[model samples]
Target chain A: EAEVAQSPRYKITEKSQAVAFWCDPISGHATLYWYRQILGQGPELLVQFQDESVVDDSQLPKDRFSAERLKGVDSTLKIQPAELGDSAMYLCASRIVAQSNEQFFGPGTRLTVL
Target chain B: SQQGEEDPQALSIQEGENATMNCSYKTSINNLQWYRQNSGRGLVHLILIRSNEREKHSGRLRVTLDTSKKSSSLLITASRAADTASYFCATDPRGGSYIPTFGRGTSLIVHP
Candidate 1:
């Protein structure tokens, strides 16, 4: 089965540095989402995209965090001047827009800011 | 705080036994969903029971929803060692098209 793809399964960085994560959703999927998961917690939605337009991003920190799906197929999430609290698992999910139901997730990029 | 709160922070059961976990939410919901996560990896969507449905089953997994009480339960029967994982309940509140809100989840350990 085709799966959502995420790069750099693990990342380690120092505080105040910048970090970027990439995700490639399943082919033909039109909706994509970015989520952050703290330890011992469920994933929290940071941003969501429908095609190339941002659908919902109320929870995203506009100050230091930004996400974009320029081509509407793949996406990138960037955190500028990361903080210790930014260390967490960043997960990517995608679903078909037409069908618009169940979502599939990628393995996720685990970030550690020391 | 999360809207959905799952019962039994952790549960240990033997193979062939049934694993039951319940979830309660604070507000009205459009649908309740169950997900599974192994270790620290991403979650896998298991089943989604809409508000109108009372019960749903897929294979050995059975889910019951009580909208009046704002509670739901997930039952995995004749489980296997591979069934061990963290289970979570998520709720999509009424009058929303965004993503669902999730609880902390139940950590189930199915020993062989």
Candidate 2:
């Protein structure tokens, strides 16, 4: 029953400020994903990481967002100069290499920008 | 942009009743998964139906996938107040990548 771990479960900040969220996947998981969920909508993929390398980041806004998993274990997502539209629930998920396609999710960080 | 769309955005049912949610996708998939998310919480995996499989069940939840029609349905029988949550359908397409597209979700409120 190991679960993904996320920090700063709730964050409130003003526009133009910098914010960062962290996630720690399951012990043996090799694939980690970052997603953003707007109100009344499903989660949208922002970036994906395989071990320490980024696999896909097409949906991520490069000008303001960046994610890294330097050690291939824990990951951090940062948004510089946050915007009002950035207020959403940031979720992290992880999947094992040889297991089923089910991805384990963390509690998520709820970001509110004023 | 998501590949799946769910019908009946919201539903309210009394306790001990059954709840059904339908989902439709636009592309060929390797698997279809159902997930539940309570208010202000993370998502919990419910069940998954592979492309080659037509029907699957877990506990009181039953999931059926029609690959030819590109549709899937999730049924929750004898539900309780705790079953009140938002349900989402995610699809992993048949290809090299592993990312799954998620639909907006169906909100179900089981009145006690």
Candidate 3:
């Protein structure tokens, strides 16, 4: 069904290290989102992008996290000096340009920070 | 967080049984959606009910929304072992075109 694509499905790292995840939204989708899903909890939005411009990042920990969609298609999320609490699934989602609510999600990256 | 909150955090059912989960929100919305995830995978969109619509159905899935009560429900009929997954309800933000907010999901276990 032309699903969203993500890389590095699983990652394990030590605390204070850095890691990055990548996502490629469905072709022609213009809106992208990054979410953090903790154990037994719903996904929490971290950042959003409209094409190449960031639309919302209020929930993002800008101090250590950064996300960019340089070409308005593929996007990357980076976390520096990861903390134990940063161990969670990082999900990337996208929606069609004309739609604002329905989103397509990618197989998220399960990060384990020891 | 403006997230929908679901009830009966978890449910256990046998194959061929019906499973129902409810979600409640606190603000006006343009749409509400239900998503499902397996043990460890990305969320899969199930059904979406718009503010102006009362109910919608897809396959064995049925979704109902009540704007007056700010609540919704998802019913999966004739469940299967593969139907075991976490279901989440998401609501469109009230004012502007903000990102959709999600509620803690209902974990459904279908016993074969």
Candidate 4:
């Protein structure tokens, strides 16, 4: 089965530094989502993309976080001047637009800020 | 929080035993989905029970949705060691938006 792909499975950085994570959704999937999962907590939506356009980013911290799916395929999420509280797992998910139901997730990038 | 709550945050059972977890939400939902996640990995889709449906089953997994009560339950019959994982219930609320709110999840340990 095709799976969502994420890079930098593990990342450790100092607070105030910039960090970015990448994700590649399954072929033909048009909807991509970014989520943050803190320790011992469920995943929380950060942003969602439909093709190359953003759908919902109500939960995203716009001041420090930004995500883009410019090509309507792969996506990138960035956090500038990361803070200690930003340490968490960043997960990417994708689903087909036409069918638009269940989401498939990537292994996720585990971020640790010191 | 729109995320909802799941009961019995943690459960342990022997192999071949059954495991059941219940989820309760605060809002009207279009559908409820169950997902499983092994430690340090991504979540895998399990089953989805629509609000219009009362019960659904796939293999050993059985899910029931009570929209009137705004609660859902997932039952795993004759579980195995491999069944050990964190089970989460995600709700897609009514309206056009399809973003799902997820609860903390129930951790299950099926010992062999």
Q: Which candidate leads in DockQ?
A: 3
Q: Against the hidden true structure, what lDDT does model 1 obtain?
A: 0.91
Report DockQ per prediction, comma-separated.
0.60, 0.69, 0.71, 0.65
Mind giving the per-residue lDDT tens digits that candidate 4 earns over A19-107? 99999999999999999999878899999899999999999999999999999999999999899999999999998972247889999
CAPRI category for model 4: medium
Clashes of each: 0, 0, 0, 0
User: Using TM-score as the measure, what is the rank order of every candidate, best first?
Assistant: 2, 3, 4, 1
Task: Give the deviation of candidate 1 from the true structure as CA RMSD.
Answer: 1.5
* Model 3 lDDT per residue over B42-108, tens place: 9999988889999999999999999999999999999999999999999886677666899999999
Q: Candidate 4 lDDT, tens digit per residue, B1-112?
A: 5466888899999999999999999888888899999999999999988888999999999999998889999999999999999999998878766778899999999999
Q: State TM-scores per candidate.
A: 0.95, 0.98, 0.97, 0.96
- DockQ of predicted candidate 1: 0.60
Residue pairs in clash, model 4 = none
| Per-residue alpha-carbon lDDT of candidate 1 for residues A1-114, written as tens digits (9 for 90 to 100) | 999999889999999999999999999999998999998888888998999999888999989999999999999999998999999999998989722467789999999999
Question: Any runs in candidate 1 off by more than 4 Å, and if so which?
Answer: none
Q: Please give the range of 10 consecutive residues that has the lowest summed lDDT in model 1 chain B.
A: B92-101
Candidate 2 lDDT, A1-114, residue by residue in tens: 799999999999999999999999999899999999998999999998999999889999999999999999999999999999999999999988523679889999999999
Candidate 3: which stretches are off by over 4 Å? A98-101
TM-score of 4: 0.96
Consecutive 10-residue window with the lowest summed lDDT within model 3 chain A: A94-103
Q: Per-model C-alpha lDDT, please? A: 0.91, 0.94, 0.92, 0.92
